[model samples]
Target: MKPADIDEFFRRLAADNPAPKTELEYINPYTLLVAVVLSAQATDIGVNKATGPLFQIVQTPGQMVELGEEKLRQYIRTIGLFNTKAKNVIRLSEILVAEHGGEVPRKRKELEALPGVGRKTANVVLNVAFGQITIAVDTHIFRVSNRTGLARGKTPEEVERKLVRYVPARWKPHAHHWLILHGRYICKARKPDCPACAVRDLCAYPDKTSERDMLEDPPVPVPAG
Candidate 1:
């Protein structure tokens, strides 16, 4: 896409949602980190369902450690890879307590050093929790970025680098959330809702869904790719 179209693309998204936020529920940075970890292969709604009660009981690393891995597993049992996620959560909490004084680190390197926290997770924590202008290229953001021709890349890391380098500074803070919401609701995987998409005209996707397809059947839900 041209520079002018790229600017307009984000402008429409930002205009639609002046303030987009993560669907995951959290009380503070500690809980935000945990929520992002739990959301690895799960839906935000699912993670929120589990974390809603978990956060009410444990908001800090100390509380999470005291809750223990076994107990944590019980809370997140519905989520995929609960056993592994539980262990990482406990281990990360312990590190936070021991090294960062129970606070989530602001730096990407330190955040990634924690168990189960990868680049995407660190970017999310940095952007949402710390107000840093970092884009976390999850499945949703990945699809929207490529489909809209805003920043096409074969890998998440490549797309993320492109977004950071190209996206306007004014739109950087909420870019992730806007793209995420767009993909989740409109530019879906199975069949994008092109008719309802705000940026359909600006999108570079060649195989746009037709009005007949939208009327015939709703798009099937697919796992994020």
Candidate 2:
């Protein structure tokens, strides 16, 4: 997309939702870290359902250590990788208690050192919990970036880098949430609602689907904008 298109695209998104936030529910950075770690390959709704009960009882590293791996599995068993995730959650909690004084570390390297906390998880925690501008390119964001031609790339890292370079500085803070929500609800993988898309005119996907008649076209300048 051109500079003007990219600028207006994010401007409209920010205007629509001034203060977008992660769908995952958490009380603090500690719980946010755990929620992001458990959210891999799972929906926000599913994670929130499990964590709602889990966090009530185990909000801190010391509390999580007391909860134990076996009981943790019982709470999150409905999730995709409960067995492994339970083990990692407990192990990381112990690490936090021993190393970081039971607080979620602010630095990405320290967060990544925790068990089961990968690049994406660390990025999410760093951004949403710590007020960082980093983008955690989840599947939804990755798909949207490629499909919209907003920051097209074959790999998530490439798309992330391109987004950092392309998106205006003013929009960087909440850009991740805007794109992710848009992909999840509007620019869907199966059949995009092009007619209702905010950036349909700017999007360059060749096969963008729309509910309108094929012969009809959206308003634009004659031959050029």
Give model 2's clash tally.
0
Clashes of each: 0, 0
lDDT, residue 29, model 1: 94
Q: List candidate 1 stretches off by more than 4 Å.
A: 217-225
C-alpha lDDT values of all predictions: 0.91, 0.86
| lDDT by residue (tens digit), candidate 2, 1-225 | 888999999987776667778889999999998999899999999999999999888889999999899999999999999999999999999999999999999998999899999988998998898889898899999998888778989888999999999999999988988888888777766667776678888888888775663235433211110
Sliding window of 10 residues with minimal summed lDDT for model 2: 216-225
Q: Report model 2's TM-score to 2 decimal places.
A: 0.92
Q: What is the TM-score of each candidate against the true structure?
A: 0.95, 0.92
Evaluated with lDDT, which candidate comes out highest? 1
lDDT, candidate 1, 93-163, per-residue tens: 99999999999999999999999999999999999999998999999989888887989999999999999
